[model samples]
Target: MSRTTATIDPAELKAAGTARQTDSSAPNADRPRRRFNWGKVFAWAVMIALLIITVFPFYWMLRTSLTSNSALYANDMSLLPTDFDLGGFARVFGLQSPEEAIAQGGSGASIDFWRYLLNSVVVATAITVCQVFFSAMAAYAFSRLHWRGRDFVFSLFLLSLMVPLIYTLLPNFLLIRDLGLIDTLLGIMLPSLFMTPFAIFFLRQFFMNVPTEIEEAALIDGAGKIRIFFRLIIPMTVGPITTVAILTYMNAWNDYLWPLMVSYTDDSRVLTVALGNFTEQTPQTGPDWAGLMAATLVAALPMLLLFLFFARRIVNSIGFSGIK
Candidate 1:
């Protein structure tokens, strides 16, 4: 006997297909779209408020820099500049002669602005370069090299982070004095030139995250540890390297106490120290508030520009380094 097959009805098949489609689409048809979250709105409001609070001082400094001396000390607080004045800036840059500066209602002190600025640039650049390079080498050894007592050594190094900079300042000053580097840019940069614990820790975390296979392959290709580090590891970690450089540069640039302690003369003084001295010793007139604000703005400009330019890379590297 031959076996027979039964065929389905077209109408029944069509109805079943329609039912399945309706069932699949039911959730979409019945579900409501999400409305904007009020919690998010509140959170953003708080953030904006905090941002304004944090940035208000810089804004005030810039505003005061543009305000005339009379406008700056006027009873009424004007958030915006009433009369735009360049005398403060001129005084800061030594653009006006003492006689002319005094004639223009400015403190007649001649600040060697360019000299201090150059000193800052040289010291900050040297510190950033040396610190980043040395920290990177230390990080490579800690992350990749096998050695006895490495962990213990690294732990001891981390302990340095706990020691306050104030505690070391006197000893560091004595050492610099012994070297006869006082009143020199080299003295200002010497403390930071070697390596910072934070920099090594930051870089080592990134270095550890690098794939071991890359180093192994480099080794198989007859590349030594130093060659592998320079070629393979460094090339892969530009983000972290640049992040450390920016950070180190910012620190060295903004450093006030150390530079002030080491350098007193205009020839060797950095921008921060110069600005502080200028503020304190304005001519027979009271503190030159507008000129001081102008000088402060000029000194802070580089760090602001640096952060604005490299902020994204800095944030990414910090996140990648597994630091909170």
Candidate 2:
């Protein structure tokens, strides 16, 4: 019945609107935030389980290495060694003489532990260095230098990757035998020293990713290809090179079949081969499980340390290559 219009304050209406908005939003602001995500929790659980699964064998090996033979052969399995015994390691290192080992009821066979360890180190290092250097050179030629039939030749290298390594073993063995490199560490390294298809392919991928402008600039300044490669390319791709080095080193160190085929004596035997021989026992006693585990732990230490140190670089290199 208010035929007469009433004036409302605009400020008052705005104030009421603001008050309603604040009141409505207050509960949402004060409410607790979600702190748990089931998906994330499930992922974390799976990751932890996988980590335990991967690491448990190494832990068990270490535990066995520290435990006494009697404890290892006991009816109940102990996750942790009850008594810390170094006798397994002692026997492995030949710190305990055969007589002492026999008296202590341990494996009495004498193994040249240090000699085999040295052999592994020398051969692995040699293979890594030679392979990396030669692979880089080949990669440079493939990626940077233009020549006839380049793609065709590279196709051959790529094709080699598809061939199983075991298939080449006989021919390689025959060649090594003809060369009188049988039972020689040099023979063990010869097959890998020149260049590997995988190594060349891996380095070539990285090399191609390198900025061509940098090489062009160097060339304009009268720098030779060799100089550019050694000075520029190498410094820029250390990550990939290190990754290749680590891979090559690991392959050489862990190689068993080839080394076993060529090496008969301890002089030429690598750690893996020596470790196999270490477990061999006469008809009287059984295999030395504890001592064998100790030697295995020792043998695996260098590779583990290498991975621990270079794992980040290796991952980064792989990621970088994928991006390119």
Candidate 3:
């Protein structure tokens, strides 16, 4: 028996390995590399610049709030806080003595921050809840239920939106006065408590997109209209409902003109009116820039937190589709 032995060349093996590597990378080598996308880069740059511009004011406000009023004028242009002090917060809360406040360029008389904040909360909350609820009900009726003159009535509502808010203020004020609700929180909330035309329209659009089959199923199961609304429709449409509530709350919370017209005393004064009055009473020296900034931050904190908490919900709701 004879055995044959084969000897392989190292150069040939090396060449074969190199060929395999080349073959493996041939597709990638043939493919074109992506070029630098100047448009995308430019877009990102613009967005970053806009973000800085938008955020800088709030940062300045916070910096001023932390700065000392006496040194504020000197360091007005400084981007950072100067002579860090808590006296601004103290003045806002009435913790500083009149002499100290006056020395710090403050008004000496502290505004009732807590009381006005409470009044704002009450008014905003009442208006938001009531307006959203009534708006949803009205939207359902307009979108889901067919009735005589439904489109006509809805068009009338849309028309109301065109009317200037200022145009109706005098009439609203007179009505509130006649009801003897002037200088009351109820009066401040009454105008917006029912439903805004915008709110009704917004909800109606979403309601119309709801699937009829699901609603029909519920009806077959003997679910009444009210039951279906509260149990099924509301649950399914939580995203839009939350959006409506947030918008309504923001409008009510930021409403200054109506509250100013109705509320005269401390009992019904909202934060906006109180802030206006606070600035008006500035001393001969100047406005208490630090204290005023601090108060403004407090006034804006609620809305900031609200947006932060429900930001995802808002994003989701904006592109919501009712189809499963």
Candidate 4:
């Protein structure tokens, strides 16, 4: 029994020694095989930095809007609102500015904020509809359909784009006045925005990028130019078209200078002009920092939300489409 026990103890000791050796060797084996990757970590850091930079402005704006007027004026400007209040938003949503509208006519008479809202809606909608229709048709002509001097005409339009808006401002104003469209929504919207060259060009490039085989197949099936455009081309490029429409709607909605110049009457005003009206208020009457900022936020909120929602699709379209 002692002899058997001595043999068993040696075997156990040998096994334990082998196990220890295996265990110690395991980590050493992995050490040579393991690769330290900094590329992924660097890429992640870059993305996080970009995200912070991109979203910071919007976060600041939200915090500022929620902050009280006195708190906003604190010596230490902060990312956080010192005193959070919603009264600024409330004042902005108030339909009538008593100082401008009600006072101008008196208590019984009210200035029409609703009218300005309606005006913005009408002008933006009409311009969007017209611009889309016109731009699409023009793009189709330049892309799929052939006409005389098409390249030359397109180049001229491109050159026109380089001319600064300031250069044509006077001419456009004079033209609007001559047409007696001054103080009218039509006057404010017609001159430059009704049919934008940029929109046409953007749509045209996307249209060209479309599979020519599809268009050819439609043509062989006895489809006309208009039919091919509506059925095949339009469906394929819906992303870019959506981007264009949103841009057009935003431009018309936020138009400040032209609307202020052409439309004076409360009957035909838009939100931008109305917001500016808040800034012109004398502090002796009552400073409206809260109200003014609120109105600006309200005006910008829609566009910001729109871009946020559609950013993915817009980016996809631009990535897929090209200038050539």
Candidate 5:
């Protein structure tokens, strides 16, 4: 040190470094949540609005169904029923007609309403059972069994699905007439009591979801195809199968056109066709709007209850089926 300055020492530098303990440019670790975002709020609002829009029709149908015809036709429509009468229900049960028991349709019979109901139940039950089983078996074969031109066959089935059902109406009628199944349950069921391309398609997708390993294990245990299917697959896929059953039941129960063509007798008429006839024949008596609504509600109740009961399982099965 030639020119002895009052040396600003290295110790001072170290002391300065200590004073300036490294500061962070980042935001504080502990801060309260930010204010509500308008964008997020709006998104939620839109979703709620869409849900209401989607659910409105069902609400309207229920409201109208519950409301009396007089109240229904009032100058101003009500979102809710005012009188809230179970008169409609009473009419459906046919209890009030006890004026010395006016025997409807002679032969001392208590009207044919129950007969029609029984016919509907029998026919719809038959269709649902046959269709579900047939569809499941066909779906299993398609999904698991490898064969020549399998995809081609599947493609052809899909093509059938694309064809408008109306296109087959004439042919179906002709076939029904030829088989002398016309005006009979066999005729009604003839059109497609045991087969549907859509059902096969719906179930095939679900069968694909089951693990190959589980099926292989069953095979290794010397289980046959039918045994494996009933024991392992069917049990595992109950949700989807139930969904199919529900859909099939609804379709069969609500069917009107084919039933109308075939079911001409009191012995064969289904509830839907009977209801239509009830509306059509303005015979001396006036339109029983309350009774009509009541009957419609009765016709609709089982599937509605079913859907409500299995809604969660239905949604889950639909998601798992890979149709989406």
Candidate 6:
């Protein structure tokens, strides 16, 4: 008989709902605030310091190149070029006359900058091409092919990596001399043109990771080893190949000692060797700091650009190419 239910106000219900939502939205009083992390701050500070230390030298080189040779001694410690001039670059490219160069405190000796640049390009390109190709072939053989005494042969090849590069210079020089290739670009190219132990090892690591099932399928299809390598394995491993080529090219481009020992004249003299001679050309005073820095900056620009362009690829490929 008593079925009466108490009536509730919609307005009260709405207000209660609003209050609950407001309470829920409020910040938590019991939550702890984050404290400043000195460790992270210290790490960032250290990294910035190292960045400045590493980059200041290049900035100084740019400053020296921009400053006039006559004023370099006066403003030796200036952060910015006090006597700003582009004549150092002019001197580098042989645009300044001997009298003009000397008046500007240069050595007045021509750099043969174009000739040396050409020689460097030729030698480096030749070495990168030949070395990468041969090394990739050798790596394919070692990693993919089954043959008697393969591991032993690879071990012997790896042992060569332990040999000091300087120890072989005399022998290589003698061999080039006997071949009558001294003072020639061919002589410079011949030594590193075939392959390097490190190159083989690097490529072998990548080659070993290629799935064997794909190769077995190619074999079933009557594809030969050469065809399979060219068509299948190579296409699958472009990243490592590119990394290797970039590294090999940079090494060949920057090589100084071998080029210095083999070539004496402008015929095969590389930029590095030319720069060394350039330092001695102005013996009366000191090295033509302005012009020398300008030339050096020019010489190093290529590798810098190369690394900048392919840096991401190299970094990303190395992790995947390593022992798996």
The most accurate candidate by TM-score is 6
In candidate 4, residue 122 scores what lDDT? 88
C-alpha lDDT of all candidate models, in order? 0.83, 0.83, 0.84, 0.72, 0.71, 0.86
Count clashing pairs, candidate 2: 0
Regions of model 3 farther than 4 Å from truth: 1-45, 315-324
The clash count for each model shown is 0, 0, 0, 0, 0, 0
Q: Write the per-residue lDDT of candidate 1 for residues 1-324, one digit (tens) a residue.
A: 254213334465456456555756776542221122233345557977999999999999988888888776665587788789987898889888889877656768677899999999999999999999999999999999999999999999989989999899999999999999999888889889999998999989889999999889889989999998899889999977888899889889988899988997887899988877764676665677788889899999999899799878877665655553
lDDT digits (tens) for residues 216-282 of candidate 3: 9999999999898898788888878889899889889898889999999999999999987875688
Candidate no. 3 TM-score: 0.83
- RMSD vs true structure, all candidates: 12.3, 12.4, 12.2, 13.2, 15.5, 12.2
Candidate 1 stretches with Cα past 4 Å from truth are 1-45, 316-324
Q: Model 4, stretches more than 4 Å misplaced?
A: 1-57, 67-84, 95-113, 316-324
Clashing pairs in 4: none
Worst 10 residues of 1 by lDDT: 30-39
- Residue 128 lDDT in candidate 2: 93
Candidate 5: Cα lDDT at 31: 22
lDDT order of candidates, best first?
A: 6, 3, 1, 2, 4, 5
Candidate 1: residue pairs that collide: none
Candidate 6 per-residue lDDT, tens place, 12-53, comes to 545644655565577752222111223334555797799999
Which pairs of residues clash in candidate 6, taking residues 3 or more apart in a chain or in different chains? none
lDDT of 5 by residue, 1-324 (tens): 676434435465455334333322234522221112233345557977999999886666566556565565464466886557665555556655644222221111234677788888888888888999988988988998778998988898888977898788878888888888877877887667778997898888889989999999989999998897789878988877888888778788888887887777887888889878764553233454545666677877777898899888777766644554
In terms of lDDT, which candidate is strongest? 6
